[model samples]
Target: MPQMSPLSWLILFMVFTLSYLGFLTMNYFSTFYSSKTPSQININSTSHSWKW
Candidate 1:
């Protein structure tokens, strides 16, 4: 079995945390934009229907 140095452990932890945060951020923005687009489409449809 091999033991890792403190610095190596620290780097690994940092990389994992950063990747996790990035994934969460991407997921959040995707959901946020998806919701926004649907609402905008609904609004546009309503406005167009009203004009007729």
Candidate 2:
């Protein structure tokens, strides 16, 4: 097994932190723009009863 050096660990941590921050920022903006209308509809059909 290979072990990462201190500098490598630091760099990996920074990259992960930045990526997480970017994801959070995107989610924040999405939430902000997610609700503009008041009405929503969802339809689900689970039965097949048709007359021919």
RMSD of each: 9.0, 6.5
Candidate 1: segments with Cα more than 4 A from true spot:
1-4, 33-52
TM-score of each: 0.53, 0.52
Candidate 2 residues 1-52, lDDT tens each?
2475877889999999999999999998787455544346445658999999
Candidate 1 positional error at 24, Å = 0.3
Candidate that would win on TM-score: 1
Name the lDDT value of residue 26 in candidate 2: 91
lDDT: which candidate is best?
2
Error (Å) of candidate 2 at residue 40 is 17
Residue 10 C-alpha lDDT in model 2: 96
lDDT of 1 by residue, 1-52 (tens): 2376877889999999999999999998787433456545644334434554
Show where candidate 2 strays beyond 4 Å.
Answer: 1-4, 33-52
Assess candidate 2 and give its TM-score to the true structure: 0.52
